[model samples]
Target: MNEFSDKLLQWFDHSGRHDLPWQQQQTPYRVWVSEIMLQQTQVKTVIPYYQRFMERFPDLATLAQAEQEDVLAHWSGLGYYARGRNLHKAAQIIQQQHHGVFPTEFDEVVALPGIGRSTAGAILSMALKQRFVILDGNVKRVLSRFLAVAGWPGNKRIENHLWQVAEDFTPHERFDDYTQAIMDLGATLCTRSKPNCQACPVQANCMAFKLNRVKEFPFSKPKKVKPIKQAKLLMLINNQQQVWLEQRPQKGIWGGLWSLPQFETDEALVAALNPSVKTHSEAVSSLVKWKAFRHTFSHYHLDIEPVKLVQEAPADWQGQWHTFTQAESLGLPAPVKLLLSQLESEYVKNG
Candidate 1:
């Protein structure tokens, strides 16, 4: 083992986490699911979601057979809906192509949907006890600080150099422990902000720490103002206390999830509601406008204006009317869920 691995392993034995939900009764399938959920999400936030997901779809066979809607329902609040969709698709592919077994070969595993090189390496190392290098976000931060890598890791050249560093640090024995160790070190001690550098195991060798510029090593991505967009969300409630929801198109933001019908402007929303009338002035006047809110995504900000109309949806519209309880079970977006809770509370208070 190298000096880096030696110190990291020693630190891991004493301080690393051992009892995460996915760590118990460990399998390739469980590890795969946990890894996917942990991407861009913190460990604490993922625990409950991981446990609930494991409970619902316990095995590869079960996940493979489950419907897309059901898979998305389990992933409702987890913002990146594409990950859930890709995971379900990967499971099905594994079932059909690999005879329901998680592939052991690196090439085969990486070929599966959403399984990038780093993710595949992680699965092989952590789950299968193979000696493969992992350069996940945590590892990138750790190594960038260790060597004081100059550019943003998103740049291909910088990423390639980090991958080389990661490969060099990986040891031949106890690959699983090392993989978890490095990630734990990064997650717990060498965090993005206000890192506990004094307690770091490799503090002696960390070039960034030595230079007193730990945070400066891993350079931030170039900034650009996220464009703001506007939408009018229609909460069309019928007399039966059911809200109208439509499934978003299979590709794009909130893909394949059921959400409130959205239009670009109030006039367009009113026109859709009053298709038979030449002018929607009367309908627009009767609409109840709720407090607007902003939901920001990674690339854009969506300023949503919610307009509640207690009119039955036209039979020609392509959507479903579901009661509050039923809508809760479907794959609704976070903002939609918030609006729904408010609507439910209002109904209870007034009734």
Candidate 2:
């Protein structure tokens, strides 16, 4: 075994975790779900999502047969909705074409909707024990520091170099444990802000530690300034206290979800939902009060006004009560959910 491998193995045997929930079974399905959910998310946060997701759809067949709404409900708080959609899509493909079994080949795993090379490598190595190398964020950090590699690690050239480093250090005998150890070390000890240099087993060989430049090797790329956008939210409340809600289209921003009827401005709002919308009751003749606010997203900012529609729904416009409890159950997008929650607290506080 290599020096890196030997030291890392010893460290793992003494301190590594073997009791993570997903480690219990290590089935291809279980590992696949966990790895996908863990992308750009922490292990602690992924646990509840992984458990709840497995509880809802324990097997490939179950996930394949689930409706989009039901799957979205299970993935409600998981933030990245596209991952859930891709998981369902991949499951369906496996169920129909492969007889409910994921293919073991590296290329086949990568061919799945959202499973890229590193994810495929992880599945093949960890779950199937096939020879492959994964290059996740933790792995990138670990390799970059150990080799003192320069340039942004995410760049294609640097990524290719780190992949070689991963392959070179990976123990052919204890590949799985080795793979998990390096990742665990980077995640737990060699963290982003303040890596515990003393706790790292490979510190002697780590070029970054030797040069005292642990923070300098893995440089980040320049960030683009996020842009801003605007929207208007219409809250059409009635005497029975029912509010108007609409189902977003199946593709695009907040797709395949239920949310309050929203638009761009007064002109657009009227053109869409409130075109000649009349009063809710004689007591509420017209809108005498309205509210406005703004929200921000990853790629852009959103300027929004949650306009209270004192007017009732027309006889032709189809809508329902959509209670708070039911809202929790529905797949409301994050922004809509936030507003609904704020409005609920305000409703209770005012009453």
The lDDT of each candidate is 0.92, 0.81
Q: What is the C-alpha lDDT profile of model 1 across 4-115, one tens digit per residue?
A: 9999999999999999998999899999998999887999999999999999999999999999999999999987999999999999999999999999999999999988
Q: Which stretches of candidate 1 lie over 4 Å from their true place?
A: none
Q: What's the TM for model 2?
A: 0.89
TM-score of each: 0.98, 0.89
Winning candidate number (TM-score): 1
In model 2, the runs with Cα more than 4 Å from the true position are 276-296, 303-305, 313-321
> What is candidate 2's lDDT per residue for 136-251, written digit by digit as tens?
99999988988888889878888888888888988898888887888799789889998999988999999999999998868887687878777777777766555667777767
lDDT: worst 10-residue window of model 2? 279-288
